[model samples]
Target chain A: MKQLVIHPERCTGCMQCELACSFVQTGTFQPSVSVIKVHVFDEQASMAPYTCFQCEEAWCMTACPVNAITIDNVIGAKVVLSEVCVGCKLCTIACPFGTIFYNPESNKAFKCNLCGGDPACAHACPTAAIEYEDSETKDWVGPWAERLNESFLTALAGEPS
Target chain B: MIAGWVGKVLKVDLSARTHEVQELNLRWARDFIGGRGLGARYLYELLQDPTIDPLSPDNVLIFATGPLTGTNASCGARYMVVTKGALTNCITTSNSGGHFGPELKFAGYDLLIVAGRAASPVYLWLCDGEVELRDASGVWGKGVWDTDDMLREEVGVPDARIASIGQAGENLVRFAAVMNDKHRAAGRSGVGAVMGSKNLKAVVVKGSGSIPVADQASFLRSQWKKKASLRDSKGRQNFTQLGTSSTLMPINAIGALPTHNFLQTVFDGAEKISGERINDDYVVAHKACFACTIACGRVSKISDEAGGRFLLHTSPRNWKMAGEGPEYESMFGFGPEVGVDDPEAIIAAHWLCNDYGMDPISAGATIGAAFELSQEGVLNGTEGVLEWGDAGKMLQLLEDTAFRRGLGDEIAEGSKRMGEKFGRPGVAMVSKGQEFAAYDGRAMQGRGLSYATSNRGACHLKAEVLRADYKDPGHEGKAGQVARTENQISALDSSGLCLFLNSGATYDDYIAEFNSATGMDLSMDDFVTAGERIWNLERLFNLRAGITPADDTLPKRMLEDPIPTGPRKGMVSKLGEMLPEYYDLRGWPEGIPSQEKLAELGLEAIA
Candidate 1:
């Protein structure tokens, strides 16, 4: 099955993925509504896109009191139903990865659902940092990605990364 | 009636501490559209009083967002600051990219106009149509990054996007910029100096209000289709992989990259400071601004081994710690223009510009002028300190300029004034008091004309006729190309899309995005005309500001100096060959737009 894969080192943190995700899900171009969050760690000088890992235990689904969070059988992705969600944000706190977010605008917990298997983030990521591939996908890192990774891992002076 | 616009303006009189909500004239909006164009309309009207000084409280500062801004349209994170420039004393409309424009739109303003100076230093706090001038006493002296951080904490909104000036602005550095998201700046024509003159520290905005689209179905479809097209574009890929510094080598090869204060067109250290080198050595990761698919912004850190023993104690831990960019223009400024070969020095200089909030383009160009001045034995003892390729001295001067210290005081006046003071005005390569962008006019002939005729004074982005210029040299059919591109870019800049979007998308793409957003059926002809209208209006404003046909000529060097080396070795910018025809085509009789021409664009000629 195709799954969302993130190569954080290759991510430029442009947030195009987030903007694309927000537009696809919310019918509006708002980063706050995006399920995929690009965290820019400045001191380390890295950008990492974090989203639902589709945990084997499904902790968010188990933690939801209303059972609003459900796994899509077709995509193997967890999605929050806007109508069913009570905005209690139990799933937001329950997720170990902190991928699920409490959106105050909608008052619902939203996480990446892989856009029903066609993830917009992957489609929008120019560097291919975020991609949609088989769960057993091999690391087919592009030359540019390799170059970016080398630059990212290169230490300020001789300090070990 | 436009779906993408708020259709309202916030007018703040800082002197009175009062604000009034005013209905934006839709008639003007129809003609000017929005962003830079609409903002230009407002600034022109605001300055009807001839007595207002560009640096005086009477001179208004406007923040305007375009129709396509805050949309999912590719590269839509654009907003404009329209004011009389402290540097050029011309009507300057400087544009910036970041999250702030979108936040302002969400806060229920299509534009914000501040007139009259505050009694003391203050910041405009904006939240969902509510506006107030709050005392910024605590944050007055801080740099842009610290001010942004402190404002977020004080305003009690962690996500509020802030556009603030730093020590450079506070000190009235001629090329100081209003910086947003720390590194992204409206970095030209001294808009920040205007901000400083008013005692205005920052403008903070945040809101949850949604920007309604006229046609969601079509908008999404076009956005998706364009995103796919952008994904496959080679130009976008290059920008993604290498950042803007990628232009260095090729521009150098073309004999266009401004080097050693325009003394030479090529730099020997081109390879050392090229984008490829920056990518291999200094790059931490590629980065982006709001909604930009092309992550051309560089996230780089200064190497700990650079022996930059000098430190600014007043700065934050992350000041020299980390930063974004040293784009080709700024890189050209800090690298070749100033003769600094060390990539680490360029990185540190980039960080200093960000923290101090100065325009690297103007700052570097100024420093280059000083280097040239020192070489001529004008500032003899100081020549040793200000000599070319001295990155340490360059760094010190950058700080000094920000705070207006010692020799920094003279440098703060910018290249033109400094040159005049030192009796070497010819050494200063500037037009209308603003320095040239990285491209030497000698090689890029079209860019030279664009610089000479630029409404914002020697700015590259204003016209950006590089592609057409490179493809059609020998001054053949270059005027029409620049005129059309200028008009079209005016439209695009008004629409609030990134200029780089022109790489992957055509005018057709711009028309589609804007029409879909606003529920308008604007033809390509209408769109192009709207741009013309905007350009003419800006021309009228400049004419009123006393920029005559004489001001529309390039520097003496560009007109006389042939390239000493490279592909275009014998070439000098033949701006003289192009101007008469360009003026005729622009409908400017004797270089000022005629009454009949203004009427053709549906604009009332300025009295």
Candidate 2:
């Protein structure tokens, strides 16, 4: 299966991925509406494009009362059925990654659907920081978070790593 | 409504503490395009009394975003700060790239025009669709980095982009820069000083709105295509890898890098402080502005030992190991121009300028002039402090200048004023009271011509002639080329695209993007004509500000003094031969625009 992979180290914080993702989500260019977000760490001089990981045990899909959230068999992306969504707050609360967002304009929950398997963000990213490829499903956020925490801990201890 | 442009102008009066939203004038928008040109149009109308003091309450300050700003167009992160420059007393249009510009558009404003002075220090906060003036007492005297952190925390919007000034601006340093995103700056002609005079500390913005285009499909297609071209472009690759610091050695090789305040053309220390060296030793990561395909910003870290050598009194927040810059201009200003080759000091000083919110070019150039003055026994009270290649004193001067302390008070007035005060106007390497960029005019004749006539004064970005001048380096037939290139660049600047895009894309690409985004069909000639209009408008503003046609010339040193050593030794700028031809090409006989030419550019009604 083709999965979305994010290499946070390669991101330049240009926000082109967000711009492209928003254009796919909403017709107009709006970062606020974009499913993908680039979290900037100015102190560390790093940026990471983060979104839904489509975990096999997807909490958002389980939390959906209206059965509006389901996984695509081919791409493994948990897709949101806006037509059937009740605009509940449960899925947002259940999601561990906090990638799922409530669209006030549409009154529907939205997350990265990988742009129907041809992700706009992966295509738009200039540095190839975000990629959609056939790879083993892995924990992208855990490694990035560990690296960030390791740096923070090193700085706190006043020791060179 | 124009699709690309937000079509809303926010007018704020600091004295009255009132604000109003006005519709953007479509006719002027078409003529000026946007950003620098659009801001010029509004400023020309609002600031009718061009002779007013730039630092006075009467002067108007405008922050304008181009039509392409906030769009997915490649390198769409630019905003123009147009006002009467406190340094030059001439109309200045300073451009900067970062998220600030796109955020302003997302906040639903195309331009923010500030008029009058506040009774107390204040910062403008634009959130969602509401504009408010907040008391800035807490962050009033803070450095830009601190101000950014404080304002973001105060506004409770961590992601909000902030453009602010530091102590340099608060003290009204003549060459103070308005820094955005903490590191990027609208960094020329004392726009920050003008903001300081208005008692404005910062402009903090958080936006959530969308920018709808006239043709979404076409805009996406054009942007993607441009990005693909940039991917293959050698210029883009060089810029991405080296981030402009690469130009230091080449310009030095051509004997164009002004060393020790234009006394020499080449620097022996160029290789030590070159871009390659910085990339090899200091660079930790590459960064970029909004939607920028060319990730040319260098995020570098100085070692604890190397950083400790500078001993700058900066906040702990700014003492972080990694920061952006030491761009080519700053590298030259803080490097060869001052005869310093210590890359670590250069990086440290670059951070000092950013934290202090100052233009490194003017600060270093002023120090350069002071060095010569002290050397020649023309300056007093500076026995050992103003010596060349002294990195410690250089950093000390930067802090002092920002705080307006002791000798820094005089240095803060800029080199032209400082030199004239010392009874040696010829010592300053400035044109129209603004310091020259890295390139020495003597080695690049067309660059000299551009420097002399740039409306904002001694700016290299106003025209594109570096490649041509590098090839020929002569005065012959440069008049027409400079004139034509200036028009094209003026148009490009107003369109809200990065000038660096010229590396991969053509004028036709910009025009196509503009047409698709704004729903306005303009040919290449029409686009250039709009630029021509913008140039003339700025010229008229400068003239009315009492800058005479005679002021359209280079400094005395550039014209008479041959480069003392290296590749272009014995070379002097032939500005005398080029100026008249340029004037004729500009349809400005005697350097005043002809009535017929004004009519042709649709400026007759105003001129």
Question: Candidate 2 lDDT, tens digit per residue, B1-607?
Answer: 6778878999999999999999999888988999999999999999989999999999999999999999888888999999999999999999999899999999999999999999999999999778999999999888999999999999999999999998899999999999999999999999999999999999999999888899988887888778888999998999999988878888989999999999998999988999999999999999999999898999998877766678754542566558998899999888888889999999988898888899999998988888888888876674464778988888777778889877788889999999899899888888889999999998999899998999998999988999988888778988888899899999999988899997777777788889999999999999889999999999999998899989888887899988888988899989999999999999999999999999999999897
Where does the lowest 10-residue lDDT sum fall in candidate 1 chain B? B307-316
Instruction: Show how many residue pairs clash in every candidate, following the order shown.
Output: 0, 0
Question: Which candidate ranks first by lDDT, i.e. highest?
Answer: 2
lDDT of 1 by residue, B35-112 (tens): 999999998888886335788989999999998888767788899999989899888889999789988887888899
TM-score, B chain, candidate 2? 0.99
Isolated chain A: TM-score per model? 0.79, 0.87
Q: Write the per-residue lDDT of candidate 1 for residues A34-73, one digit (tens) a residue.
A: 7788886655667788787686677899999998988788
In model 2, the Cα lDDT at residue B164 comes to 92
Interface root-mean-square deviation of model 1 in angstroms is 2.1
- Binned by DockQ into CAPRI classes (incorrect, acceptable, medium, high), candidate 1 is acceptable
Q: Score the docking of each candidate (DockQ).
A: 0.46, 0.83
Measured against the true structure, the TM-scores of the candidates, in listed sequence, are 0.91, 0.98
- Which TM-score values does chain B get in all models? 0.97, 0.99
On a 0 to 1 DockQ scale, where is model 1? 0.46
